[model samples]
Target: MAEQFNFSSPPFDLLRAAERERLSEALSVGYYAAGETLIAAGSAVPCLFVVLKGVIEERGEDGKLFAQYTSDDIFDIRGLFSGSSKHVYCAVEESITYELPASVFHQLCGANPDFGRFFQADLAAKRQLARRDGQNLAEFILTRIAREHLLPAIEVSAGLALGDAARLQLSRGADALLVRQDGELGIVTRTDLMTAHFRDGRSEAEPIGPLAHGPLACVELGDFLFDAMILMTRKRIERVAVREDGEVVGLLHLTQVLSLFSTHSHVLAMRIARAESEEELRGAAETLHTLIATLCGNGIRLRFIMQLVSALNEQLLERLFELLVPPALRSRCCLLVMGSEGRGEQLLKTDQDNALILAEDLPVEQGLALMQRFSEALLSFGYPPCPGGVMASQPAWCKPLAAWQRELNQTQLEGQPEQLMRMSILADASPVAGNRQLYEGLRQGLLRFAQEGERWLPDMAAAALQFDTPLTILGNLKTREEHLDIKRGGIFPLVHGCRVLALREGLEERGTLARLGALKARGVLDEGLADNLAESFELFLQLRLQQQLGGARDGREHGLDVARLSRHERDLLRFGLHAVKKFKQSLAWQFHLESR
Candidate 1:
């Protein structure tokens, strides 16, 4: 027996002093030559193996390779539970493994719940644990909920005169007053009172009940503050009621939510909404970089940051469209945002990707001029023009609804690379503003196109497999190159793979995570793999964002320096790349890519 286990790594890293001692003392190094089978499928459980040298391959009952274990890689932890092997573990070469007795492992698991949970959980949960290992405070700060930031709602009776209600709201310094009427709750804002008095010819003496809006949009008190923020943004409201155990307890306003992070995102969002001209919009858009930096520095989670940035970008684009597009033509067309922006996964200001869909053919040369000016205006606002010219200004992207459908159908008939790329990009396209029907019409046609073609998916799926995972799982978790192009090597594969899966399943979700969840629900993708891929994709985004925030002024990076990361960060990167590999392999198997 020797002290061979590295307590510095994950799972072991989660254990305390005494727990580490127990593991260190029980660790025994054993040598196995090449082609040695340590455990066969259905065999009784043996000691857990932690590879210290060489490589080991995990193959399923069908003898298909599943995973590889290399230096510092642990395997067969499932033996701690069922006490039997479900896969064949064979040494790929002469290797040394730290054999921890099953009984000792169980004792250590019981001694450290966090350590135990990591081994017991699925890939998703395991990755989450690995990320939260030494970052408890950061996690808590980034995941604050509505309950922690509630503003005690000032409730006013419905019978109270509108004038008294308005005065009460002013005296209490509340932006909105809740009115309880007939076992229902309603909300009245200052604007509501003013509009009623001026526009409806009603005096302030009227009952507050008639002025108040009922069945208010609400979020659970325990809901994450980011989720509450999304609710208010989507509903176009200033505040939301917070409910606790089926009863309204408090309210969450825009200002209070924005206060969680000392950023000017709210102010910027308002400015975009109220902008009357392109110049005014450009002035507001200039502050976007500062807001992104502020939010990132405040330790906001990557998901929340992407969502908030996406929402603000949408508001900006919509406002610009309103100012530029004629009122007469606005009802005749739909504006769509495609690619990362459409997916709501973009963090920094990347290139512009948008399109316009008209309802029918109409003579409007002036409208076309405005559409062409859209891209130039966006470039002036600091968003770089799309390299491939996917902007709405291009005639290829700006077309009628029927023309868009025809192009998609033509892409299927003739497998052109550019057309395929457009389809892939269009898969993530979503309407930011305008006629929702036009967007739906295009989506339904695309869905039908996907449903009709069966063998064609393998060709569409080939693009997802174009890139290789950068980290080496067969060796020590090391990068293949000095600098890793994480976006292409990691993010693209995960995103495109998930997109192909969604198309095959006919899922309407445009976001990668949302599609993964939908695919998992339909049993089209394994739950563990789905969750792992999601967390891994997010890990890539987080890594890229960190790199971008540090430098990557263009939002496109030269590469990610793996050597610059901490031990924990480096480990997460390796683990995430492995998730991408698993997902890519699954896609290959599903599409029968090998046979092709």
Candidate 2:
């Protein structure tokens, strides 16, 4: 029976022989009678069960069966790692199964690098699925935050000296301070203290009052980690002083929130939310580059960070829309972000591509006023006005729901390059705020339109295939004398390629990596080839981020020359560019485009 099992597919495909053997042996066959409880709900979990030959069902707290499992299905692994007994698994049939004990699973995976990679890939796939399904399970989302939760009440009073506060912060080694002031939990950071004292010429004895920020925007401990994340971003602070009855009890630092996701995410959301003015947003925007740099330096997962940051950006723009648009019109219409922003893959901030879809037949004057307000608000929020003016402010983009469908239908019929180009941008649009149903309709309509006119998708693919990968004659990466625009030669190809694949597959995933994986999963892109393409996209993003950060560190406005990249960077860039070349070839074949 064990011999009949195939561990050939990813992530098991990456596992070393010894590691696979260890895992296989540890996966002992277990049998359960029908109606038997296999794993209890709300108990400390010990192992994950892979249903090999039986049916297992999960019942949620509502006592409603939520999930059904069959052969080759995996479940409860995240729970085992979380040490949470929150899921109940019961046998729906008298069945034989593979039970991988959490301890043995951890031991084997930890002891073997290949095993770790195998598990990581499997887990990442599961998470991507959960996200697409909108599961909203905290354990599914927070799996990457590996830090042990800190102890309670590491506090500092509001008026503590900067020197003393700095000492306390150093002693704690935590990135934040919780100040109990005005019946609210205010937070001040060591960075805040440092910036104020050293950069702003504030005195250490100047009464930490000047340094402390907040009137804590609160979140219940029982709330989703995303709740804490949202509050932190909304309040524009690094540390959120966790309060119980208005007294500081614990602290949630931005670093902790990021640790819950990954490193590159630490400041991404906060930076966007804290931009009180457009100038600040411009400065904060550059930090995205630094974030990329630091994440690359530490080898943090890049895909998750991209999703996380892009999600925050959407939220930020949504919030800005909510604040700026009049209550009535805001409710009557949806704000949609198109182009790369819509695709959930934007790295550097670029021209805003947005549109409005309003409830059918509203007063034209009111509708136009709302769009104008939203556009101005976004411009003030640091998104430059679109050069093409394909914004809500434009009558062409500000439309009723039926009108949008008509435009999309027209574009599909004509297959106009100009129209296709515009539709491609519109295709990427996601609802930033307002009437979400309108955006949902937009998504559904676009998906239907793309599917019905599938032949036109290859044309879009051909356009994406136009960007040549920067591979040199000796198979090295060619860099410009000034600086390589990774955006043009590398990132754009991946982004556009993914968009083409998304349109072809009717997959709604907006990120480049996600589209690549989804396409690969559907056998639209080969597995190894997809992985290589993803790696190149990640490396390109990482390098661009690093260059941006280096510029910021030097207090410069522009990025660095990719041609003069350091030795390690040069090698990595070459490797990534080669991968991009291969990815471009794949695109060419997919579209039947002749290579130049």
Please tell me which predicted candidate would have the highest lDDT against the true structure.
Answer: 1
In terms of TM-score, the best-performing candidate is: 1
For residues 45-105, write the lDDT of model 1, one tens digit per residue: 6788888789899888998887787766677877558889899999989998888888998
Clash totals in order: 0, 3
Error of 1 at 264 (Å): 4.0
Q: How accurate is candidate 1 locally (lDDT)?
A: 0.79
Clashing pairs in 1: none
Q: In candidate 1, how many Å is residue 262 off?
A: 2.6
- RMSD of each candidate? 5.8, 18.8
Residue 130 in candidate 1 has what lDDT? 62
Q: What are the TM-scores, per candidate, against the unseen true structure? A: 0.76, 0.55
Instruction: Encode model 2's per-residue lDDT on 268-362: one tens digit a residue.
Output: 66566666654565565556555555544544445645655676677567656755666777767888888767877665566778888888857
Error of 1 at 275 (Å): 3.7
